[model samples]
Every structure is written in structure tokens, then in C-alpha cells.
Target: MTYCVGMLLDKGMAFMSDTRTNSGVDNISTFRKMFSWSVPGERFITMMTAGNLATTQALISQLEERTKAPSERKPSILEAPTMFQVANIIGTTLRDTIAARALTGPVAASPAPNFNASVIVGGQIAGMEPRLYLIYPEGNFIEASPETPFFQIGETKYGRPILVRGFESHMSFADITKLLMVSFDSTLKANLSVGLPLDLMLYRNDDFAPFHERRITADDPYFEKISDSWSEALRNAFHSLPDYELDA
Candidate 1:
């Protein structure tokens, strides 16, 4: 399991993803779940993955190879004229990768392993406005909108409430980063599968490149402060609520 979020903001876009992967309690590792590609002034694309490790890795590998050899691949994300087209290309590639794995892996007599993964992709092209999309395991996707300006994939429930309550379209990048840290901290406390370090990225509108990017390690002082402060705040808030009394 993993946790990843891509948000659309008035200033631009922000993304965060945890780096933990595990087959069992005994087998745990850290692997990057976020990736980005940019062409200086032309375009910028970022992707976050969740679900089967192999499927996600294969999907990312193919996308990377296509970017390096766009002429051979024909329709790479870097060459896609619009963010919508880029989403389409990524969705199609993910669906095809899963299908190919299913067909080539095991015989039909037995149930195949789960080769399913989902992706959150967002970015901007030269003339187009920034866009965000959630691409499913089946290749279908939906774009983020004013009504739904953010996307969260994988182990999402533990960290969703704060985002729903606190996210504001006009919030500054600093505030947004703090909000994401709280969200991730909550998930890390609740689920062992969602361990850190975490990857964070922020893009300013029309910049076509990341404005800020950082990896928050377990010992990072800012993250530690956020976690402790959030916990204390939550406890104080709970205590402040009027206590319930049994009916007479």
C-alpha cells in the first residue's frame, strides 16, 4: 500500500507521496513513488503511483523510455500537445502494461497475480492551463475540476479529512506544504504500510518547472514539529469539546 496526493491550487499544483512498500511485516523497503519530467520552457509533467510495485515500476519505466526515445514511441508525454492528451497516453500505456503482464505471466488455468496500479498525473504545456488527472487501473481517467480540485490515490482514507477541511484554492505554497505534511503525518501514524520519507513537489502556474521540491526524511525537523504539533492540537481540540453526560 502507498499514499499519494496531487492537488490543483490557484497558484499552481502540489504533490506528495510516501516512499514505503512492503510485501509483509518482515519485508519492507523504500522506493520512490513520484516522478517528474520537464522540457525547460515547454512543458512540465509529474506523476505519482500506487498499488502493485511491479506494475507501477513497469509503467514508469516505459514512460521514461518513451521520453528518451519519443521518435520511436511516436506519442510520448513530452510530445503530447495538451495535458488531456498526455493523460490519455499514460492511461493507455498503463492499461496495456497490466494486460501484457497478465497474458505473459501465468497460464490460464490459474488465477493471475494482481498487476493493477493507479496513477495521478498533472502538469502544464506551453500554451495550455495546468491540469490534473486520476488514471485508473483500467485506463479510464477523470480530470480535476473546480469542484474537485485534488486527487488522492492509495491508502487515502486515513489522511482525507484534513484535506477536505483545510484546503483552500488560494492558499500559499507554504501553507499547502504544511497542510500536506499534516495529512501525511496522520497517515503514517495510522498505517504501517505508509511509512516515510516522503517526496513533495510544488509548481507555480506557467513556470513549466518545479518551484520547490523536497524529500522529508524520518528525522527531518520540520516534519517532526508538524507531527507533534498536530497531535497536541488534536488532543486539545477534543478536550475542549463539551463532555457527554448520560441521560437521567
Candidate 2:
């Protein structure tokens, strides 16, 4: 399992993802789940994936190959004129990969390997507004709107509340990063399958390139600070709330 989030803000877009995959308690590994491609001053794209590791890996590899050698059947992600088209390419690739895997054998049988996966693709094209999308296993996707400015995948429930309560359109990139970190921290604390060494990408509006990118390890000073601070803040908030009293 893993956790990844992409946010759409007035200033730009921000994405964060964890690098953890586990088949069992004793079978654990770390693998990068974020993929990106950019053409300076032209276009930029980033995708975060979760679900069956093999399925996601194959999906990304297929897309990467197509970009290198695009065909009518397999168009390059960079060639897409619009973010919407880029998303369609990704969604089709994902759904096709899973379908092919299903042909090999039963994906849902007990002790059977799974071939289900999902992705969140976010970026900007030279001529259009920045966009964010959540692509599902079935090749269907939904874009972020004013009412829903962010999308998360993999172990999402543990961290969604923070985003729901904190996201804002006008937030600066810095504030958005902090909010996302807190959300990731919350997910990490509650879920064993999602571990650290996080990938973060920030793109300023109309840049057509990544504005900032970094990796946050468990020992990263800033992330450490955020985790500690959030714990203390949550405790304080809990204590500050009024307790209910029963009439005797």
C-alpha cells in the first residue's frame, strides 16, 4: 500500500507520495510511486500511483515507452495538446494493463495476485489552465474542481479529514505544502503499510515545468518538526474542547 495526494491551488499545484509496498508483515519493500516528465516552457506532467505494485509499474513503463516512441495507438504523453487528453491516455493505458493481466488468470481468488491499481495525474499544458485528475482502475477519471480541489489515492481515509478541513484555493505554495505534510503524517501514524521517504513536487501556474521537487526521508528535519508539532497541536485542541457532562 501507499499514500499520495495532489492539490490544485490558485497559485499552482502540489503533490506528495509515499514509497512503501508490502505484501505481508514479513514481506515489505520500498519502491518509488511517483513519475514525471517535462518539456521546459512547453509542458509538465506528474503521476502518483497506488494499488497492485506490479500493475502500477507496468502502467508507468508502458506510458514511458510510448512517450519515447509514440504511435497512433500509443500516443506520447508530451504530445497531448491538452491536460484532458494526457489524462485520457493515462486512463486508457491503466485500464488496458489491468485487463491484460486479468486474462492471465484469476486476480481476485484467495492467494491470487492482484492486478488493480489507480493513479493521480497533475500538471499543465502550455495553452490551458493547470489540472489535476484521479484515474481509477476502470479507466474512468474525475478532475478536481473548485468544490474539490485535491485528490488522494491509497490509504486515503486516514488522511482525508485534514485536507477536507484545511484546503483553500488561495493558499500559497508554502502553506499547501505544510498542509499536505500534516496529512501525510497523519496517514503514516495510523497505517503500517504506508511508510516514508516521500516525494514532493510543486508547480507554479503557467510555468510548464516543475517549480520545486524534493524527497523527504524519515530523518528530514522539517518533516520531523511538522510531525512533532502536529501531535502537540492535536493534543492541545482535544484538551481545549468542552467535555460533556451527564445530569445526575
Candidate 3:
């Protein structure tokens, strides 16, 4: 269980993913679920994954290895001429990795999640418009359109309402980031599996390099402030709403 989001904005794109994984109440761990690749002025790619940790890691590891040594898995994500092609390559790799894991069965003491992994992929390539996609466990994916400017994976229900109500195409990068912080914070409060230390990435249009990227820990001052303020605001909003009166 994890929470990850990718937003496509007028200026660029942004992504956030939590670093929490747990097997049971006693066994909990943190692992990064975000990966990025870029080639200066050529292209930039960022991905956040959720679902079976083993399946997700196997997919990411295979993608990373392909960049170092390309095999029949098609060109590395960095080599893809367009963001669409990059998504295809990633989806294929993910499907293949899960299939292989299924064939091998449970490994010793560790178990994989029977091909249940999904990813949010986004970035831009030189000459192409920025794009965002939600890749499903079956390898099929859908892109963000004007009607849908963002995609969220894993533990999504708790935070989706905020995005649905506040998202806008012309919002500044800062504004969108703040919105996402609120969303993530809300999800974190309601879900135990999705813990803190979130990874954030921002890419400005055509930069081919990230505008900003960082990990937000529980102790981070800004996140702390945002969390506190959002909670208070939500409470106030709830209290301010008009109450219904019953007529006898």
C-alpha cells in the first residue's frame, strides 16, 4: 500500500510518492518508489510505482538495467524518441517482469504480489509536448487529457476529491505543489500503510531537466506547516457549512 500522484500542468509536470511498505503490524519498512531519467536537452522521464513491492521493483530494476545494457526489451526509456514510446517500453517491461515472477512462484520466504503493480509515468521529450500516463497492471495505459490533468496510483480514494475540486490547467507550479501536499497529507492521515518521507519531482516545460526534486520527511518544516494548516482549514470548513433544519 502506497500513494503516488502525477499532475500535468500548463507550465510543466510534477510527481509525488511515499516511501512506506509494510508486511504486517510488526514489519514495516521504507523504500523509494520513484525513478527518473534524463538526457540534458534530449528528454526527461519520471515514474512512480505502487502495488506489490517485489513486482514494482523488478519492473524498475529491469528498466534501469536496460539503460545500462539494452537487450530485446526495446531501447531504454532514455532512448525512446517520444514519451509515448517510453510508456510503451515501460508497460511492456512491467508486464514481462510480472509474468516471469508468476512462472517462478514464491521465492523461498519472500512472496510477490501475483502481477499486481501499477505505475504513473510522465515527462517530456525534445519536440514533443509533455505527457502523463497511468499504466495498469495489465500493461494498458491512459493519458491525462484536458478533462483530467492528473493521475494517482495506490490508496488513491482518500485524496482524489481534493484534486478533483481544485485542479486547474493554468495553475502555477507552486500552487499545484501545495495542492498535492494537502492531498498527500490527507491520505497519510487516513491510511497507515502510506507513511511519510515523500519523494517529489518537478519538471518545467522543455527544460529536459528537473526544476526541483526532494524528499519530504515528517520533520520537514514546510510539510509540517502545510499539514497543520490543512487540518485546521478542513475542520473550519466543516463547521461553517450550513446545517439542515427539519420542519415539523
Candidate 4:
């Protein structure tokens, strides 16, 4: 399992994903689940993935190949005129990759492996407003809007409450990053499957390039501070609530 979040902010976008994969308690590994591509001054694109590692890796490899050889592959995300079109291309590619993996034997005689994955993609193109999308395993997707301005996939329940209470459309990049850290920290504490070092990316609207990007390792001092501080704050808030009195 993994955990990934892509949030739309007035400033642009923020993405964070954990790097843990496991087949069993005894078998665990770390692998990045976030990727980005750009055409400087024209477009900037970022994606976060959750679900089958094989399917997500294959989908990303195919997209990378298309960018490298657009003339041969066709409909590359870099060449898509709009972010909407880019989402369509990614959705189609992801769906096709899963389907192709299932055709390994006689259709009626063999059962397909679970090649299911989902994506959260967001970015901007020249002349168009920044956009964010949640693409499902089925190849269908929905754009983020005022009513639903963020997307989370994989082990989502453990971290969702922090985002629901803290996110703001007008928040600065610094604040959003802090919010995501707390969210991931909550998940890490609750579930062993969502271990870190986390990958983070921030983009400013219309920049056509990432504003900042980094990895937060287990020993990062700033993250340690955030985790401790949040726990203290939660305890304080709990204590502050009025006590109930019962009739004697």
C-alpha cells in the first residue's frame, strides 16, 4: 500500500506521496510514487500514483517513452494543447496498460491479475488556468473544483481528517506543505504500510516549472518538529473542551 495526495491551491498545486511497498510483513521495499515532466515556459505536469506497483511503473514508463519519442508514440502529454487533453491521454494509456497485462493466456481459461492503479495529475499549460484531476483505474477522471479541491489515494482514511480540517484555497505554499506533513505523519503513525521518506513537489501558478521539490527522510529535523508539535496541540485542544457534569 501507499499514500498520495494532490491538492489545488490558489497559488498553484502541492503533491506528496509516501515510498513504501510490501508483499508481506517480511518483505518490504521503498520506491518513489511521484513523477513530473515539463516543457519550460509552455507546460508543467506532475502525477502521484497508488495501487499495483507493476501497473503504475508500466504506465509511467510508457508516458516517459512517449515524451522521448513523441513523433513515434503520438499524443504525448507534452504536446497536448490543454491539461484536459493531457488527462485524457494519461487515462487512456493507463487503461490500455492494465488491459494488455490481462491478455497473457486464453481469455476464458485464465483470470487476470489485479493490475489496478489510480492517478492524481495536476499542472498548467500556457494560456490555460492551472488544473487538477483524479484519474481512476477505469480510465475515467474528474477535475478538482471549489467543492472538491483536492484528491487522495491509497491508505487515505488515516490521513484525510487533517486535510479536511486544515486545507484552505488561499494558503501559501509553506502552509500547505506543513499541512501535508501533518497528514502524512498521522498516516505513518496509524499504518505500517505507509512508511516514508516522502516526496514533495510544489508548483506556482503559471510558472511552467516546479517552484520547489524535495524528499523528507526519516531523520529530517523539521518534520520531527511538526510531528511533535501536532501531537501536543491535539492534546491541548482535547483538554480545553468543557467537561460534562452528571447529576449526583
Assess every candidate by TM-score. 0.96, 0.95, 0.93, 0.95
Clashing residue pairs in candidate 2 are none
lDDT (C-alpha, whole model) for all candidates: 0.95, 0.92, 0.90, 0.93
Q: Write the per-residue lDDT of candidate 4 for residues 1-248, one digit (tens) a residue.
A: 99999999988999999999987777899999999998899999999999889899999999999999957747899999999999999999999988887776356754545778999999999999999999998899999998899999999998999899889989999999999999999999999999989999999998999989999999999999999999999999999999889887
What value of lDDT does candidate 3 attain over all alpha carbons?
0.90
- Candidate 3, residues 1-248: lDDT per residue as tens digits? 89999999889999999999987767889999999999899889999999889999889888888898865456888888888888899889888877887778766546544567999999999999999999988888999998888999999999999999988979988888899899999999999999999999989999999999999998999999999999899999999999889896
TM-score, model 1 to reference = 0.96
Clashes of each: 0, 0, 0, 0
* Model 1 weakest 10-residue run by lDDT: 105-114
lDDT of 2 by residue, 147-244 (tens): 99899999999999989998898998889889999999999999999999999999998888787999999999999999999999999999999988
- Candidate that beats the other on TM-score, 2 or 3, i.e. the better one: 2
Error of model 4, residue 205, in angstroms: 0.5
Error of 4 at 30 (Å): 0.9
The list of candidate 2 runs beyond 4 A from truth reads 70-73, 106-108
